[model samples]
Target: MDILSDLWLGAQTAFSVWNLLYCLLGVFLGTAIGVLPGLGPTATIAMLLPVTFGLPPETALIMLAGIFYGAQYGGSTTAILVNLPGESSSVVTALDGYQMARNGQAGTALATAAIGSFAAGTVATVLIAFFAPALSAVALTFGPHEYFSLMVLGLVASIVLASGSLLHAVGMVLFGLILGLIGTDINSGEMRFTFGRFELADGISFVIVAMGVFGLGEILSNLENEQGRSVTLSKVTGLMPTRADLKRMVAPVTRGTLIGSVLGILPGGGAMLASFAAYALEKKSSKTPERFGKGAIEGVAAPEAANNAGAQTSFIPMLTLGIPSNPVMALMIGALIMQGIQPGPSVIEEQPVLFWGLIVSMWVGNLMLLVLNLPLIGLWVKMISIPYGFLFPAIVAFCAIGVYSLNNATFDIWLMAGFGFAGYLLRKLDCEPAPLLLGFVLGPMLEEHLRRSMLVSRGDATTFFTRPISAILLLLAVLLIVSILAPAVRQKREEAFTDED
Candidate 1:
């Protein structure tokens, strides 16, 4: 079959010595940075994008792909160990993972995360190979109305990730949307809220906000609470899960991979949304729902699996439709364009080696990550056991360095420090950063699609309902919000994200 031939060609290209070495290097760097607070694949790839210009397109992409999935693997490590999610998608992982760490089950949580990620990555790779073109077609069918409706669904779903007051969550999402408006307007060619500072011209960097909130913010919270610091330094007991833990994780992993693979095909809905939705679903379905925000292994397993699977399958839109599914895939698209390669359906036939080899490399990278991470589980858990006095300084330093690297400006570093203080205040207010970050990330895209839909429809607001897919998505979002208002559902929703008083 032509597919078999394509696979064989991809294997030959991906397994070459140089490609394999680059793949290993990419994943290694990805894991190292991913273990650090607030440095994610998007920033790392953006920084290295210049260096890759000199390399072959295939080799460069293969390496970048490795970094992406590798970071997904490593993000779970920090989420489990320190209650800091190095990657945005790992936010929910910290809910249960950090509790597990405090309860002396860090090793088990980390192991479960790793195993679930590997399984998901492996499955997503095959799905990409078999269904990329078909999925791309489905994605292309989504017009601006559909996209706006989809993002509406995403924003409403963001509330599910919050355990605090639903009102606070809505407020944070609105706040994030406002922050996202600080940059120049796309259509009017006018600045919204730059405040006469050119630094605000591009608005705030996500790196600055996330690192400050999750990385620096977390550091401040811990320093102020001496008891939390001691609990964070708990001993690492079992390095592996009991048989029951393994059995319980199986269903969640399977469900997460399925959810992730489907969601990943949506251009604006990649790993972050996939992980959030997966965790929401898992908690909703669990028999002992109260265990979720505590130390539930299912929480760790499902989100990890969803994130990795989403990370892999996100390429479907980028590779086949010339649309980026996330920031990393956008960077991947830039790399392809720089190499004089145009993305879209033609690329598969015209640049078979690049397309298929990149696909093959994903599976290769997953294998490398599994091999790289499994043995170091013990070492990773132990590193956090260092005295908080010594540990926090290093985290703050890394956060500053990572934020500065984003645009090579000292201003972002200061911005991050400011947000750090704000994060601590929010912690005191009992709010989670996840919903705010989610809103910030999705806000611009949502607005863009909404405006486009209106423009295309000649200012007709009925377009969203007139379109079937858009209508269905909006209905679902509405239904979800209505259901959350019910007494029984509202109580459960609150329980899912927040601890009971």
Candidate 2:
């Protein structure tokens, strides 16, 4: 009853004319960006973050949240139409979605994806409304030791789950941590890694780093293969799914929503992981696994549902615990900071309107996406044919403008360029940048919590172990690391025996 009342208040706030307009604008822009290949939600949000600076905190947050989940709705469009995944989470969608298009069921695939996304988004929103407050109440009891241990677990999970060699992920995390150390020491009031540059005293802008790595680096990568690429927009037929199609999709959609909702709440887990896991689960559980990559509607339905559900639920950790599950959530944290709102357990209680309104807005945004995607499918298909030559330059321009707009500092622009080059090089080396971004975001908080915990315990390292919560978190971190490495060791041993044979 209390929850319903709060949600009613939230619905009232979210339905206001200004909030509704911003929400509509956000989803519209998000769908546009998601239709284009290689321009993901992270880059789009980072670049457009400045646009939210002037708005009220609630409105800004509402708009940003809309964009985050709206991308999930739009990403499946490209995956089905041109076989290009606009978002990483849509990669699994492309496998079967593109096949569906090739089989002349493009409209059915798109319709299924949109409907599944809406269903999952609605369920996830309700879950957040119910669970976030409970999570916040639990998090309110955490001390510095527990927080530090939680961060350690989060970072470890990020590295372990990142798609690449374990060693490379570790190296990237270390590199990001080093980069994070550039600013002045918060406790000692002394410069640590600034190297005498006064600009360094304030620390490197996270916006710059995000835009460089995700925005510019992606542009550079796309340009490399731009010449050889061609898009064939499949004609969408049968906009409505048949009764049998709906029956086949219902079970997978339900399973995917459940899988995504659970995973999205975990540290360092988000849409990408959820989508991949959902597809794998669907394939494994299907009576005919061989049909998975051959225009299977279940494959299209499951991952699309999982992706949208995860995208919405991933906000749970960031909102309730101030822990970003992925880079997009990290950017949301950055947005919160920009609005002078400290993201943590207190956010829900302290600013009930903002928190609840944001939650309600998510449901509204999902509804808008369902209404908007179908009519705009043709426009999105045409967008897929735009040449890279025109697209990359515009992206570069937006990134530069967005970074420079942060503090109006030319140095930040240069710094972004340097990081852009670094990001490109890192990509060329097959190292994933996602873990690096997580490390960079978590580094300072981890350091602050570690120092505070040590001070409380007078430098006794055992304090972390003595605290029940901290100890459990640390144990989980250790288990996660071992889980990742043990398989590699066994594989290496097997390879050695095969070589000998």
Candidate 3:
């Protein structure tokens, strides 16, 4: 009854004409950008963030949420049709999907991916509606000590992410922390890293950082490594799967949904992790494992299901615990802050409309993708043929315009350009910008909690160890660090990420 009431409340907000239209536009643009290779959700969302500034918080968030999962749906289209994954999460989908295409089963693979993704998204939506509230209730009790420990655990856990090079990830996080420290000190009211510029008093805006690093940085990187796309199937006919194909999809979809839901809740876990893990699981569990990369329908179905489920469920931490599971969620935290809404346990109680509305809109957006994507596959395939040279100028112009609109200041634009160049250099060095973004987003919160905990304990450092929940969280962080350092475990982690594709 409570959930039913909550859903009703959410539906009211999500189903408004303007809200529905925003959601549609988001999914449509998300699919279009996703269909084009090399544009991931983080960059797409970052690029489009300025467009959402005029809308209400709930509507803006609903639209952004649509773009995220819509990208997941659209990615499979590229993988199956062009043998080029549109998003990183769709990389595994390309393995069997492309093989199926070559064997004249392109339509069948696309159908399987769509259906599995719909099933997984449907289930994951309900799971979030049910699970997020409980998680938030638990988080409501977290004190400064517990919160500080949790942030430490998050930073440590992120170091072990499938992102390349543990040392590079750690260094990026520290770099982000240093950047986050540039602002004035909240407690002491002293300038920390202003460097004699009055403009630096408020520190760098997260918006500028995100736009430069993900938006401009992505475009720069893509231009650097741009390649021609070879389409395997320009014309697809059969959009329906056979009954046997449906049967094969069922079990894998179910298992993937479950795996994705669980992993989606973990620190640093997102759609990317769930898809890779799901593909690996199906491979390891298959009776004829050799068929995985050779047009196996289950290979297409399982990861498709998992990525959608993971993409949906990854909202749990951001909505409830105020911790981001991925870079996109980190940006969502910034979005909430810009909306004057803090992302934490109190969000549910203070802004039920924003919370429940977002959850409900995901299902609506998923349904829209399922209905619209299959019929538009041809259009998406055609989009891949368009040269990147045509799109680059638009992206660059938009980045400059968006940053300027933030505060109507040209300085932010210049700052974004600098970060874009820096991000490009870092990528060349094999350093992932994800951990750095996470660190930038969480650093201030971590410092605030640490200072609060210290203040509460009269500057006693042992207070974190004395609190039961805090101690357990810190211990888990320690174990994670220790495990990553062990040579055997480290090797295994590397192997897991070393996919054949």
Candidate 4:
């Protein structure tokens, strides 16, 4: 079928009453939670996965996708109003957004963010509809050797792009790979890391780990600074930007959308990186670079647009190549698995309703967010004032309930608590949880592909290098590792010279 026909069918499905309701509900919940500091779409979706068990696959997926991008809109609200970024992607937004709020332009900043996000999301959705099929066709040619090499490149890129010490990130990835080994081995049927527990034979639940690490752990971390959260609730004035403001923002938003659209398609690149890159680009290209971080409208508009665009396009790899670009996409992969669907090239061909419906729903969800956030701006402003004393307990309660609901097992709850403590410790050590989650998500696939490749090559280790695609991918992986270490090496050399001087 042609793309137009497929999209038409998708529109029919996405516009159905039930699907529309799910879309609305997802955006509503997403925006609400995103306005709250210390909560993000990852934790929110992880905590709510159990609720979707009874839902149809398309409905559940639509809602989940809604939360992912809807949070982009809501995150900027908190960033502007409270100077607290609700998600990592909003960190750049808070720089100029809070400054705008301090200058009594909170309403303008919020409106700019809302409008820029809407524009970026609309364009990104169209890009997905156009490019996903072509990408899927390319992905169909991948063999086991190529798949394994691609995964290797992805993992290395994730580690290199992640913030903090390279050593620490590597350690976290290894730890996650170890954790992913805690189940029966598919080849030998041997219990690898179950520790003599039958309940663990199937493997550790992704939801439990995600909720503990991101949801509960974030709550604990927030509690540490809860007493010091002094939000500056600047009164919002002027709900619309001036003509000059629009004129200034137009170029930045467009540039940001383009940058985000490209980066979002790369392995291990997502909203966080896209926002940072867009903000940097804006600052570098600005005639008045000194005006940045001091309420520059471009600062707010660029990152906001980039983040939303990145969020939308990041779905492409997961849908078309079965390769998750980030932790959130990994969670979506898990969700697809739960629905008895394997994510890959064939998904679009075999499940056109699911594919097209999700694409159309993203556009619908973006509209819902635009409508929902603009009218409810005042409500979100008040929500920022909610005390952590009242908030953390409710979050803890919801997390516990969600974990238990996964299997009606108290053991899972205990397991979640254990991981929560581990997560806190990891945070204290300044280790990023995102890479760990990605590693954990890809571990099984990595192992599967490795085994298949090895078997096909009759244990010949040269197979990865013999195949052109696999060789190129492995070369890229090596280059990424070298590039990451080169910076640190250069820094050390500079320090040594300074010491000698």
What TM-score would each prediction reach against the true structure? Answer: 0.67, 0.95, 0.98, 0.95
**How many Å off is the CA of 17 in candidate 4?**
1.2
TM-score winner between candidates 2 and 3: 3
Residue 61 lDDT, candidate 2, scale 0-100: 86
Please list all clashing residue pairs in model 2, or write none if there are none.
none
Least accurate 10 contiguous residues by lDDT in model 1: 226-235
TM-score of 2: 0.95
- lDDT against the true structure, per candidate, is 0.79, 0.87, 0.89, 0.88
lDDT of 3 at 89: 89
C-alpha positional error of residue 389 in candidate 2 after TM-score superposition, expressed in Å: 1.3
Q: On lDDT, who's better, 2 or 3?
A: 3
- Per-residue accuracy of model 2 over 384-490 as CA lDDT, tens digit each: 77887988888888888888888889999999998888888988887788888888888888899999999999999999999999999999999887876797764
Please report how far candidate 4 places residue 352 from its true position, in Å.
1.2
Winner by TM-score between candidate 4 and candidate 1: 4
**Candidate 1: segments with Cα more than 4 A from true spot:** 1-117, 225-359, 401-408, 496-501
